[model samples]
Target chain A: MDAIRTEALTKHFTVGFWRPRPYLALEALTLQIGHGEVFGFLGPNGAGKTTTLKLLMQLIYPTSGHAEILGRPVGDVEVKRRIGYLPENPYFYDYLTAEELLEYFSALFGHSAAERRRRASALLDEVGIGAERRLQLRKFSKGMLQRVGIAQALINDPEVVFFDEPMSGLDPLGRRHIRELILRLRDRGCTVFFSSHVLSDAEALCSRVAILANGRLVSQGALSEILAVTIRGWELVVSGLTETALAHAQSSAGIRGATRLGPERYALELPMTVPPEHLLAKLVAAGATLVSLNPLHDTLEDFFVRQVAAAPEERGLESTRG
Target chain B: MRAIGHIAVNVFRESVRDKVLYSIVAFAVMLIAVSYLLAQLTAGQDLKIIKDLGLASIATFGLLMAIFIGIGLVWKEVERRSIYGLLTKPIRRWEFILGKYVGLVLTLLVNVAVMTAAFYAVLAYQGWGVDELARRAWPAPPMDPALLSAIALILVELMLVTGIALFFSTFSGPFLSAVLTLGLWVIGHFNTDLRNFENVVESRAAAWLARGLYYALPNFDTFDIKAQVVQGQHVAASYIALSVLYGMVYPALVLTGAVAIFSRRDFK
Candidate 1:
C-alpha cells in the first residue's frame, strides 16, 4: 500500500504589508511513497522540499489539491496516528528535559504509562541519548539535541515517518549514525520520507529520490535512473610529474581537463576512448609516473547543481552535455 | 469523552504545578489577614468590614486566577506548537476548549477552597460574638444565609471570567485575551449600574445604547450577595438557584462562541 499520495497538492504563502502576492511554495506536487520505502526529497535551498513535508504532516494547509496517507485523506487523525514527523530546525520547550518532552508527547498520543516508559527508553537508547537522559535539552549540544529530536519522532512506533533535514548540522559520525538509523527504520518495515539539501546524505540514505526546484518537482526516481544520462569518464592521477611531462599533458587532446592535486602531482579526466595502457605509455614517455587510474561516477551534488540551475520546466532527469 | 478527560487531567496537573496558583492563594491569605487588621480601624462595624474585605478578596482574586491562567491555556498550546499534536489526535476542537476551561475551573475551585478555609480559620481565632448583633442588621458568620449566597456567587463569577478568557483566547493571543477578560470583568461588575443609568438617561438613543451595553456584558453585580451577607439578610435558596441558572447559561453562550471561533482557526 502507498503510505503517502498527493495529487497536484499546492500551497501558496502570501506576505507583504499591503500587496500580498501569493508566493507559491508548493506548486502542483504529485507523488507517491510506497510502504516501507525510504524516499528522499532532494533539493537546494528554497526548493519547497520542507513545504511539501509540512503539507503531508498537515502542519500547513494546501491552497488547492489534496493528499492521502495510508488510503485515508490527509489531516485525518487516523492517518496522523500512523505517521511521525520531525520538523526542520525544531524548537522544543527549553524547560523540559528530553524525557519530560517525550512523556508529554506520549500523553498526547494517549500512550499507556507502561508503553510510554518502555518506548521512551528504547528510543533514547537507539538514538544514543540514554547517557544524557538526565540532562535538560537546553544544555544539550546541537548534535545531541538532534538525536533527541529523532528519538521523539520515533516515540509512537509510527508506520510512516517524515524527517526534515534530520542529518543537518551533524559531524561525520553523527551523520553516519543517522544514516544507519534510517536503514534500521527501513529494516523494521517503516516507510521513511525525508527532505535534505545535502545531496550526498540523500544519496547514501534514500533508495529513491525526488528532485525539486522552485516549488516544482523536476525529477524523481532511483539514484541509478536519475543519473543514467550522466557522462561516463575515467580519472587518472599522475604522481611523478616532471615539468616536461606536465607541459606535454597540458597540451594533449586525450586529457580533457587537468587539475593539480599537489606539487608534482596532477589529477586528469580522460576520455573513454583513451585506454589506461595508452595513457600510461604517454605519461611515461613524457617523463611522468602514472599513480592511479579509476572510473568516475557523478555524485548527487553534481546532479543538484545542474538540475536546479536549469529552467524548472526545461529540466529533466537526463544529464547535461559536457 | 475519554480524550476530553485525558486533556483535562493533564491541564489540571500542569496548572496546579504552576507557581501562579500558589501566588494567588498566598496573596488571598494576605488580603484576608489585612482585612482583619483593617476591621480594627473601623470603629463600630468591625464584623461588616471583615466580611466585605474577605468576600471581596475571594471574588477579586478568583477573577484574577480565572482570567490570567485561563487565557494562557490555549495560547500556551499554540505557542509551543503542541496544538498540532492535539489536533492530530482523535479529539475534537470543542473537547480541547471544554477540557481547558474545566481544568482551569478546577484550579480556581481549589484556590477558593484554600482561601475560604484560611478565612474561616482566622475568623474563629478572632472570636467575634454574633449573639449581640441584630439578626437582620449584622449577619452571623459560617451559617449566614447571605454569606453562603455570596460564596456561591463567587464561584459563578469565576466561571463567567473563565468563559470570557477562554472566548478571547479562541482568537486572540494571551496578552490581548487577558486585557479583554479584565475589561469584561469590570463591565460585568458594573452591569446593574449600567442598566440603572440606561433607565434614567434623558435621550432615548443614549438609553437604548446603555441598555445594549448592559445586556451585552455579563451582569456580574447580580452575583454580589456580599452586602446582603454582611447585613445579616436572609437570602432565599430559590434566588441562589436562579442566579446559578443565569451563571450556567451565560458561560455556555460564551463557550459556544469560543468553540466556534477556535474550530475555524487554521493553527498555521
Candidate 2:
C-alpha cells in the first residue's frame, strides 16, 4: 500500500462576519506517496502545502474528498500510531523540559515508562538536544525548539513521518543537520514526507517531488525525470587571447555570446548543435589557450521557477502524472 | 485511559507552573488572615464573623481561579498552537477535553485544601485565646470539624463552575469565554430569583422566558451550605446527597457538550 494517498481533498475557509465569503485554501488536491520513499511537497508561501499536511493530520477537516495513511483513513487513531508529524513553526508547552515533553509524547503512544525514558534519551541525542534536555522549552532558541520538536515526533518510533517546512528558520548548520536526520529516516526505511519551499533541500534529499501552486498540484515526478531539461549547450572559457581573437570567437557560427572575463580572457557560449571539436580548433588556431569547458545542466530551482511562474490555466493544462 | 492520564498530568503540571495559581492562593491566605483582624473589632461575635469571612474568602477566590484558569485551558493550547502536537497523537478530542478539565479540578482541589487548612488553623488559634486570663474573660468556642463539609460543598460548586468555563473555552477565545462563564455563574446563583420573577410577571411571554432560564441555568445556590454551617446548624445528609448529584450531573453534561463542540472544531 502507498504510505499516503489523497483523492480530491479540498478545504474552503469562510472569512468576514457580514458577508461570510468562502475562500478556497485547497482545491481537489490529489496525491500519492509511495512507502519507503522521501517525498517532498514543494510550494511557495500560501500554496496550500501546510494546509494539505494539516488536513492529513486531521488538525483540520477537508471540505470534500478523502485521504488515507497506511491503508487507513487520515483521522484513524490506529493509523496515527504509525505516523509522526512535526508541524511548521511548531510550538510546544513552554513549561515542559525536553525530556518531559518527549516522555509525555511517548506515553501518548502507550510506551512503557522504561521504554519512554530509553526512547526519549536516544531521540534527544539523535536530534542534538541531549544537552538541553533538562532546560525548560521556554529557554530554548528557535532552532533548539525545532530540534526538540523533531525529537518528540520520533519518540514513538513511527513508521512514517510528516514534516511541514522542516528546514524553515534554521541556520545553515541546523539545516544541514536536519537534512542528515531526514536522510537517516529514509535509510531506515521510514517513509519521509515533508513540505518545503526550499528547492535546494528538496533537490538534495527527495527521491520524488510534487510542486503545489495556489492550492493545486502543478508538477510531480522523480527528481531525475522532473529536472531533465535538455542541456541548451556548453560554456567554454578561453584566456591569453588578443582582442582580434576574442572578436573572432564572438562572431563564430553557433556562438550564443562571448562575455569578457578580463583583458586577455573571454567566455564563449555555444549551442549543443555546435561541434566542440570545431570550437577548440578555432580557439587554438587563434592562439587562445582553453581555460575550461563545462556543461550547463538545469537545476531543480530552474524547473521550480518555470512551473511556479506559469499561469494557472497553463499549469492546469500541463499537470504532470504521478 | 492512559492517554487521558498523561494529558491530565501535563495540564496539572502546566497549571502548577503558572504564577497566577500561586498568586491567587497566596492572596486567599492573606484574606483569611485579615479576617482574624476584622473579627477582633466585632468583639462578642468575633468567631462567627471569622468563620463567615473565611468561608466566603475561600469560595470567592476559588471561583476566580476556576473561571480564569478554566476558561484559558483549551484556548491557551490553541493560541500557542500546542494543540497540533496533541490532537495529532492517537488520543481523541474528548479525552483531551476531559483530561484538561480533570487537571484543573485537581489544581483547584489543592488550592482549596491549602485555604481550608489555613482557615482551620486560624480558628484553632482563636479558640485557644492568647493567655489564661483572656480565656477566662471570653472563652473561645471549639473549632468545628463540620466546616470541612462546607469546604467540600464549595469544591463541588467550583468543579461545576470549572466545567462551565471549560465548556465555554472549547469554542470561544479566552476573553469571551471568561465573560460568558462569569455571566452564567452570576445567573446560576440567582436562579431562584429568576423563578420568582416568572411568577410575579403578568406578561406570559416574559414569565415563560424567566421560567425557561431558571431551568436552563445551573442552580448554584443548591451548593451553598455556608450559612447553615457558619450558624452552627446541622445540614441534612439527604440535601448533601442531592447537591452532590446535581454538581456531578451538571458538569458531566457540560463536558459532553464541550467535547461535542471541540470535536468539530478545525483548530485553524
Candidate 3:
C-alpha cells in the first residue's frame, strides 16, 4: 500500500468582511507516494505546499475530497501514531527545556518514564542538541529550535515522517546536518515526505519529486526523468586566432554564436548535428591553437524555473512531459 | 487518560512559571495582611471586619487569577502556533481541552489554598493578641473552622469561572474571552435581581427577556456564604453539599460546550 495518497483533495478559505470571497488554497490535489521512498514536494511560496501538508496532518479540515496515510483515512488517531510531522517555523513552549519538552511529547504517545528519558536523551543527541538539553527553549536560537523540533518529531519513532520546509531558517552547516538526518531517516526504511523550495537540496535528497505552482501540481516523477533535457550542442574554445580567422569561424555553418575570451581568443558554440572534428579541423587549418571543449547538461534548477514560469493553463498538462 | 494527564501536567508547569500568577498571589497575600490593619480602624466590629475583608480578598484575587489565566490557557497555544505539535499527536481534541482546564483548576486551587492559609494565620495572630475590648465584645474565637467552608465554596466558584473562561477561549481570542467571562460573572451574581426585574416590567418582550436570562445565567449567589460564615450564622451541611454540587454541574456543562466547539475548529 502507498504510504500517502490523496484523492482530489481541495481546500478553500474565506477572507474579508464587507464582501466575503473564497480563496482556493489547494485545488484537487491528487497524489500518491509509495512506502520507503524519499519524496520531495517542491513549490514556491504560497504554492499550497504547506497547505497540503497541513491537510494530511489534519491541522486544518479540507473543504472537499479525501486523503489516506498508511492505508487509513486522514485524521485517524491510529494513523497519527505511525506518522511524525515537523511544521514550518514550529514554535514550542518557551518555558520548557529541551529535555522536558521531549519528555512531554513522548508522554503524549504513552511512553513510560524510563522510555521517555532514554528516548529524549538519544533523540536530542541525534539532533546535535545534547549540550542544550537542559536549556530552556526561549534561550535557543532559530537553528537550535529547528533542531529541537526535529527531535520532538522523531520522539515517537514513527514509520512515516512529513517535514514542511525542514531546512528553513538554518545556516549552511545546520542545513547540511538536517539533510544528513533526512537521509538517515530514509536509510532506516522510513518513508520520508518533505516540502522545500530549495531545489538543490531536493535534487540531492529526493528519489522522486513533485513540483507545485499556484495550488496545482505542475510536474511529478523521478528526478532523472523530470530533469532529462537532451544535450542541444557543444562549445569549443580556441586562441591565437587572427581577426579574419575569428570572422570566418563566426560565419561558419552550425556555429550558433561566438564569444571573445580575450585578445586573439574566441569561444564557439556549435549545434549537436555539427561534427566537432570539422570544427577542430577548421580552427587548426586557420592556425588557431585549440584550447578546450566541453558539453553542458541541464540542471534541476533549470527545469524548476521552466516549470514555475509555465502558465497556469499549461501546468496540469505539463505533468505528463516526464 | 495518559495523554490527558501529560498535557495537564505541562499546562500546570507553564502556569506556575508565569509572572502573572506570582504577581497576583503576592498581591492577594499583601491584601490579606493589610486587612488586619484596617480592622483596627473599626471600634467594636474589628474581628468581623477582618474576617469579611480577608475572605473577600481571597475570592476576589482568586477570581481574577482564574479568569486571566484560564482565558489564555488554550489561546496562547494557538497564538504561538504550538498547537501544531500537539494536535498532530495521537491525542484527541477533547482531551487537549480537558487537560488545559484541569491544569488551570489545579493552579487556582493552589493559589486559593495559599491565600486561605495566609488569611487564617492573620486571624490566629489576632486571636492571641485580642485587647480587653475585643475579648469582651466577642467571646467566640477568631480562628473559626467555619471559615474553611467559605474558602472551599470560593474555590468552587473560581472553578466555574475558569470553565466560563475556557469555554469562550475555545473560539475567541484571549481579550474577548476575558471580557465575556467577566461579563458573565457580573451577570451571574445578579441573577436574583434579573428574576425580580422580570416581574416588575410591563412590556411582554422585556419581561420575557429578563426571565430568559435569569434561567440561562449561572446563579453564583448560591456559592456565596461569606457574610453568613463571617457573622457566625449556622450553615447546614446539606447547604454546603448542594452548593458544591451546583458549582460542579455548571462547569461540566460549560466544558462540554467548549469541547464541542474546539473539536470543530480548524487550526489554520
**Candidate 2: tens digits of C-alpha lDDT, residues A1-322:** 8999999999888776787767777789888899999999998887888889999999999999999999999989999899999988999999999999988999999989999899999998888885779999999989888888888888778899999888877889989999999999999999999999888999999999999887788888999877655566888998888888767766766788888899888888888888677878887998889999976668888888888888373222222111
Q: Which residue runs of candidate 3 sit more than 4 Å off their true CA positions?
A: A229-296, A313-322, B129-136
i-RMS, every candidate?
3.0, 0.6, 0.7
TM-scores for every candidate against the unseen true structure? 0.84, 0.91, 0.90
DockQ for all models: 0.34, 0.76, 0.76
Query: In candidate 2, residue A31 scores what lDDT?
Result: 85
User: Chain B alone, model 2: TM-score?
Assistant: 0.94
Give lDDT per model, in order.
Answer: 0.79, 0.87, 0.88
Winner of 1 and 2 under TM-score: 2
Report how far residue A180 has shifted in candidate 3, in Å.
Answer: 0.6
lDDT, candidate 3, A1-322, per-residue tens: 8999999998877766787667777789889999889999998887889889999999888999899999999889999899999988989999999999999999888889999999999999888886778988999999898888888989999999999889988999989999999999999999999999998899999999999887778888988777555466778888988889877866875688888899988888888788788879888998989899876456778888889889374322112110
Per TM-score, the best of the predicted structures is 2
- Model 1 chain A is weakest, by summed lDDT over 10 consecutive residues, at A313-322
Report clash pairs, candidate 3. Answer: none
TM-score of chain A for the candidates in order shown: 0.80, 0.86, 0.83
